[model samples]
Target chain A: MAELSVRHLLGIKDLTREDIELIFETADHFKEVINRPIKKVPSLRDITVANIFFENSTRTRLSFELAEKRLSADVVNFSAGQSSVKKGETLLDTVNNILSMKVDMVVMRHSSVGAPHFLSRHIKANIVNAGDGTHEHPTQALLDSFSIRERLGQVEGKKVCIFGDILHSRVALSNIFALQKQGAEVMVCGPATLLPKYIGELGVKVETDVRKALQWCDVANVLRIQLERQGGDIAYFPSLREYSQEFGIDKALLDSLDKEIVVMHPGPINRGVELASDVADSEQAIILDQVQNGVAVRMAVLYLLAQKG
Target chain B: MQQQVILGKELLQVTLRRLCQEILENHGDFSNSVLIGLQPRGIYLAKRIQQILKEDLGKDIPLGELDITFHRDDFRRRGTPLRANATNVPFLVEGKKVVLVDDVLFTGRSVRAALDAMTAFGRPEKVELLALIDRCYTRELPIEADYVGKEINSMISQKVNVQWEGVDGGEEDKVWLVLSENG
Candidate 1:
């Protein structure tokens, strides 16, 4: 089981529990490499990776870039906003053009669902989906689970609740699938309008009440409200103040709990909205750790995928 | 398959003691030298060397474990991907003498990778190799051991196996040469 079960990491659903564990094991090694003084490896020196992003991203883009650089892989960054995508260039044409330059792997983030899957069908190079539309962000889910396992020892048989906007968050969906596969009890907590009707069929417990959801789980992974992704005209809730009063996680709320539930967030956090500023900077929050683990996890993903013959 | 014992428990004990004596002769007091074990199998022999050295010196010496999975040249050549182990080089190796310990020295590729992996810690003033079993006439590189316990000529199809006590239910430590019929 040294190699990953799958060739590409398009989504969490495509990964088995063993594959996830293997990634974690590899990530454990990369984590040590990154913490060292040199903080680099020559594993991918002969390989070239193209990071094609069709959507705007800050942390994920930088994290993937850092991961590639740390592995000593030659990197070419392509952002849709600055590319010929503005001139109506098709996805296939853009990728094929990159492949013509002898790229070995493509790490893409597109606004359309299954964009990487679509590319995999036509392209010869390996594809890693950073995020596709509101679909799956596999690396985020992996780093989150890795952070949880780092904090609490193991993910098996643990109660984990994903709190906040569920209908539009790829993090929530991937977390549910990854946690469930790893034998953790999952619960999704959010406003009813934000939680999709099909969520229950995924075998995760659904709760609209935030306090009860927090009380019932060992970990609370809070997500930001995807206001941009949400149709601008439609409002999921009445206002920000009311939503914060009902859903925002503050230090006082955490202090009220009988047990300390490890809090996590996939940044950039909407400060004072889903999570309070105090809680975000609190020692209990693993937000910074998740960000740091993102690079190691992505390095593990790239290093493993490049090994596919 | 055929198996032949190269070194039994008593011979191993004497070899380890002799290796420690040579180490103490070269690195007096061990204040400026560090022992580094290559990961997976080398750590066992390294621990034995460290223990024997400590018994003679009356103090503990710095030891570290290095994993060269990422530094290997055969990243995508093998059928199975390489898995990494933990590398706990807690102290800096800057301007320090490093002694790399391993259970067996076959093709010198792993030693080459270990040299590359050591750069992350810092530059070493000098480097030396220590192997309990040196598989003769099989080195793919121009690498030689400074402290050698025993040397044996083996075929490509024959594998050198080192079994430590309390590991894999073995009652005592032994080195065996395993010969397969195909080769």
Candidate 2:
């Protein structure tokens, strides 16, 4: 299983256990490369990558750019805010224009679902879905699982609970798939209005109580309250103060647990809203490790896809 | 296929002793020099050399292991993607004399990739190569070994297997030459 089974990493749903394992194994090597005095490698020198983000992003964009530069790949960045998309250019037209410049790979993040999937059917270059709306964020799921495997030795049979905003989270959906594929138990905890109705069909346990979910799991991956993505008409919770009082993880809640569970968060955290500042900066939290692992994992994804190209 | 033992355990020991003495001639006391082994197979030879040097010199010298998976030229050209081994180069290579240890010197491609990989650490003052088995007259690149254990004249179709004790649960250290009939 030296090569990945799929060419484009559209979602974790398209990946097998072996594909994820291969990516993790390759990421272990890149992790070593980044830690060295000279962090760059010339593996992708002959290839060019175009990171086309249809949505605004700071961390994912910078992480992808750093990964490309570390691999010595030529990079061209295109943002929808500044691009011709605002001038009524279609998604396909935008991508075709970038493809005309001889880009070997396209790392795209679109606000629409199935944007990368639709492009993969028509485009010639490799496609890596950075994040496609609320559909899936595959690399984020991979790095989360990798972080768990790094801290807990393995993902098999270990309990993991995803807390907060499960209704509109691509991270929650992807993590459920990735963790379940690796033989880990998953539970989603949030208000009933915030959790999707179809979450139970995905074979994950649902818990509304934060303490009960925390006590039952070995890892607690707290997600941010996506106010931007949440629709204006639907009130998922009563208020921010009420949501924090009910579901937010604080040090006192963590201290009440009989076991010391690992804490994680995919960033742009709302500080005191979902995760307390002390808990985010605590020794038990691996939020920083998740950020550092993002680059190596993205490097692994790009390097493997470049092999297929 | 035809198989033959090119170097037995006793003869391999004698050859290693001579190679160590030659290294001592060039790098006395090994104060400013380091031993770096290419990953996967080369590290076995490198570990053996380091062990013998430590026993003889009564001092532990610096040794590093470098993986060249990302530096290989045949990345997507090959049928299967290349898997990487752990690279454990803890010390900097800047301004220090370095010796790259490997079990066999083949088409000189691995050494070429190794030369490229070593630069990531730092620019070494000087560099040299040590090979336990030199498959002569088959190098595709303009590269040669600095220290050779034994030069065996063989066809490109012939395979050289250098076996070390305690590696893959093997009993003895021996080198075998297997000639494939297809070529």
Candidate 3:
């Protein structure tokens, strides 16, 4: 009886350690199935999943669509760019209208924070938060944790340092909750002004220095500095040049560590900013592995949610 | 808690040897036959038989594992997520005879699911059911094992516990008849 109690996967904040483990356990099976000659399963044949992305994304949307297709679920992709969302329809009316056609599950990415959480309360269908406005990306955190678990043998007691934009990045918050829940120590590394005021209360160790954080952790998940979220003219830091000089992860900075450690990034990589192109493509980098695992992790989340309905 | 000892290691060894020899009579080299262990439990028995074929009889057999957790008819009715195991059937079953190995043949629901799960890879030339313990006349479905070690008259409440030395904590092979709630 490894069923998760939640109707929606809104965030890691709402999921217990057991829910996370069950998702991983189920993901293990999906991982094997995807590698087979016939990379499809009949598990969710009758279930239809809708990918509703109000935000622009390439990797998360495609990975989720593939995951649904692999599970044999009929998928309908939606975006605000081409939908009634551009017209005058509200989020509730739009989702309910989609559900009127009986979309069993929705994997949504929205610009607004807590959009998935808001929709889950209003709709009967299961909602999975792909990414919300700096709130949480549960699946990203899950895959990041899953990747770390695969590399380090276990998530428990392993030190994970999440660097880059801490305040504006949903992945950083979700990883903190997920890694902490699974018995991993969390350290957040970024510019002092860029981190959130709530960081002090999140029970995570804050190290503004990336070099020191790298020395102190097992795996360093270097987050992409959210360029879109940052205003064009607004000065969060002195400049990108100063920010990179102090906080950016280059090969030289990574080499300063006692031993070469695992480096990760949630994709659409800033080749020269948060992580260097050399370090991003290095042997220790698991960026590609994270992309490959995203499909398996999403499949597990969707399958578990479908079982409840 | 009162029960009867169905088969000890000595008796069970003789029965399994006869069963493997019976398989050898029909499936000589087992080149065309593939042995599939049902998920979690049947795997041990499948491994045991495969070991005997390789060690004692010098027949190298192709062994695979099949997990029917998803193909189950009662999947929706069950409370928990069907914690899936690996289904490692690398070879195509298109023309191969599949020996579906399981521990106990009771209701035959698992065998039915295994048949459904096996079709995902390819349709087999033939399929055979092998059970370590067959509770005769207790099947909900009209199913019978072709290679049954022992036929015991077991109540719905009485469970047949088969322990292999490699898997369980027991020293040797053993079978125990224990009572359930309905007993």
The segments of candidate 1 whose C-alpha lies over 4 angstroms from its true place after superposition are: B181-183
Looking only at chain B, model 2 earns a TM-score of 0.96
Q: Give chain A TM for each model in order.
A: 0.98, 0.99, 0.97
lDDT of 3 by residue, B1-183 (tens): 666789998998888888899888888778799899999789988998998888756766988899887667675566655678888887888899989999999999999889988887788899999999999888988788999999889889777888889675777888878866443
Write candidate 3's Cα lDDT for A141-166 as tens digits.
Answer: 99999999988899999999988888
TM-scores vs. true structure, each candidate: 0.98, 0.98, 0.92
C-alpha DockQ of every model:
0.86, 0.81, 0.50
Off by over 4 Å in 2: B181-183
Superposed by TM-score, candidate 3 places the C-alpha of residue A184 at a distance from the truth, in angstroms, of: 1.3
How high is the lDDT of residue B177 in model 3? 89
**Cα distance off (Å), candidate 2, residue A78:** 0.6
Instruction: In angstroms, give how far residue A45 of model 1 lies from its true place.
Output: 1.1
Per-residue lDDT of model 2, residues B1-183, tens digit only: 678899999999999888888999999999999999999899999988888898889998899999998998887788877778889998999999999999999999999999999999999999999999999999999999999999999998779998999999889999999987554
How displaced is residue B177 in candidate 2, in Å? 1.8
Which docking class does model 1 fall in? Answer: high
TM-score ranking, high to low: 1, 2, 3
Query: Which candidate number would show the highest DockQ if scored against the true structure?
Result: 1
